[model samples]
Target chain A: MKKLKLTIAVTGLNNTDNPGPGIPVIRGIRESQEIESRIIGLAYENLEPGIYMPLMIDKTYMIPYPSSGTDAYMERIEEINQKDPIDLIIPNLDAELYTFMKAEPRLRELGIKTFLPTMEQFEERHKANLVAYGKKYDIKVPKSSTITSHNDIRKIKNDFDYPVLVKGKFYDAYIAYNEDQVTNHYNKISAKWGLPIIIQEFVKGTEVNVVALGDGLGNTIAAVPMRKLFITDKGKAWSGITLNDEEMIRITNDLIAETKWRGGMELEMIKTNKNDYYMIEINPRIPAWVYLAVGAGQNIPEALVKLAMGEHVAPYHDYQVGKMFIRYSMDMLGDIQEFEQLSIFGEIEQSQLHYPNTQKI
Target chain B: MKLKKNIAVSENGFLFDPNSGESYSLNKTGQLIVKLISEGKSEAEIIENIMEKYDVESNALQRYLDDFIMMLQQMNLLQKEED
Candidate 1:
């Protein structure tokens, strides 16, 4: 084997952890030789010829820090294609995924391969349209509405209470208890971010997130169900446990089938007291916690990466079930301050961890 | 902050939102924040506690917290009443 030379266009080099959790799927695939990874973040420099660094595989790569818009963004992908053949262009962050999806046709014409759902299906899955999807699927999703003004949120607050949530169509979600709090949050977020916003009903229930890797043809190849064993201040799943969630598993299959969905997709669902899992929102791009799925067993990142490189991967395989993950760094203090955070997940009967292993921690 | 909430967060740091009835994975910093938040620590309070104890900058930590805290508010994890 010539060691399949595959190039991954990632968000950025931003971490010190050898194979940080952000893109663990890629790490899992390159397990033997550590495939080549080129990261482009909010601060990549254009001067350096993004060759593989010494820390990374020998293949050289560029780190184009600030990817501006369609033109410059497309240029980076195009440049790679012009040089050595680029294998896969995986958009990890929300902004990049949205932009890449919008400019998909152009990128394809230029001979760059990528994996993502169509723009129509993509729009249907965002937080802004979650309610509409609930209605479409006849599943009890949250009462979702767009917030163009303070008055829009007031309508929900007056009827509801302080436990209202404001969600970004992209990669952000905020839980505000009062009308004033939401207004302040909306102003701060709207003026500086990428897209519009959506406000959701505060349903009291259990939160479950399901991730599935689908072939571009609407066929789901693999699925992973996890419970948040730990979380960040912003409600990010800090640590989690993989489990055999039948209902969640069914909801996922049912969702993509209804949408005739394709490409890789992730769903955020909240099951209420009645045990009804109300579909919350969707992230079309790769979720940051993908490492857990890889660590558990199924290496979707490698599969997706291989697929992008036009490789014929094997049929889907079930990953390591019941695995748990914990992120490091300063923010981890939030996990400590908030002990009840991981108390929600009652399903995980077993777990798995990286590095120092769970025995010591 | 009591451990009475439905969300099952593990010791090694796994958070399950039994409220939403869904499970998720987190990193170490994320584990700490969720643990603290679940323990009922306020945002400023969490920030103050974390800053004094860690090597990360305050602004960066706050920025990273921007999303999860908002999620806490949205999911009712932060509570509707102001402390």
Candidate 2:
């Protein structure tokens, strides 16, 4: 008899071997003899199997516009399905969330399972929607306003502080100056994204990501919030440390519970001087540091699969603390023109000593 | 290098990852799987147990569970338990 293989349809996987922010960790999972799975990168192409082959996938989905535009990259999922049906489709990235949401009914019909949120639920948690969710959840998100038109940007320049955050339709967020600057930037963004403008307060402080798994029934499986030390201009988590912030965990869980969520999530939050966590963007997908969670003894991927299998997962207490994760490369250019565009901190070249990457961590 | 595991056995999902200071919360099925791994259950036996409970397909479960555990070992959470 042929052994059964549980297939995971991975969306947003680009064909490459470079250690990217996502996917490699999934590969690591396969390499460790922990899980059995195949991958679909961007609708076409499969990485040939090798040491990395167990973790490498050659399939993808192209839905869910980024702060930019929807890439239609997910159209390939259908092609891969024609060969062998996927058991579960993990919308492993923010870009694929909308794609998964749209494909939810079809996926269910095909017997593929996924913990997908509704479009409204997804939109409601978006950064621009943060102000509204904050109002409802009582979480302190920065002061933000929606931009339905170019004139909205003009109104914002006079109203709010400069060096403000300009959010895209997807997850990529950047900062801009006064109205003209915002308009120019928005024009470029809208041209590429076809998304409405999201002008928000530029928050300052140590940024952190609270990675958690939630039951659709309002219970939490695990939560690991991290404080970031470095970032790309695009606002990806570059270097960070995992800390046990009861306050942060409580507030983030409170918000998730209120929303009645059922899936894995990663949220970007800024711990201000007042020690308040001002809510920023929320990514509904699992984070790139999912391997970090696995390292910490909380394997969300394993937990998530069990839940999907309808097995009762035991809820374990979080007793670990003060673990740090650092990503290092000689390319740490402290002085770059692009750094200021995405950074809240000014010119100060921090040491390579303080940084750590789990690969090098 | 090949992967090894030294997971503790009990009803509670108490995983103390000595490599990373992060503790874990595991569900019942997760507990059983970890126990099986600690007891040195082969991949085939684990799959048989999984099939007994889950109404879902096995091939997919095997792939996911295989990759999932491998990830644990790569992260150093799974190591050979010294008898």
Task: Name the lDDT of candidate 1.
Answer: 0.62
Docking class of 2: incorrect
Q: Which 10 consecutive positions of candidate 2 chain A have the poorest summed lDDT?
A: A345-354
Stretches off by above 4 angstroms in model 1 are A1-4, A12-22, A32-67, A155-161, A309-317, A330-361, B1-83
Q: Compare the candidates by TM-score and give the number of the best one.
A: 1
TM-score of every prediction relative to native: 0.66, 0.65
lDDT tens digits, residue span A1-361, model 1: 5556555555433333322233354355556343455432121432111111222322323433234767876676676567545555666556566677888788778766788788888877667777777788877787767877766776656555557787765645788877777887788778766447777788887677877777666556667887777776667777787865668877777776777665566787776755688778777755667777777766777767666776676645466555778877532112221223223321111121111222311
Q: What is each predicted model's overall lDDT from 0 to 1?
A: 0.62, 0.62
List residue ranges in candidate 2 displaced over 4 A.
A1-5, A15-35, A39-55, A58-76, A328-361, B1-83
Clash tally, candidates in order: 86, 58
What tens digits encode model 2's per-residue C-alpha lDDT throughout A235-280?
A: 6555556665678778767866788777878887887655578888
What number of backbone clashes does candidate 1 have, counting pairs of residues 3 or more apart or in separate chains? 86
lDDT of 1 at A265: 67
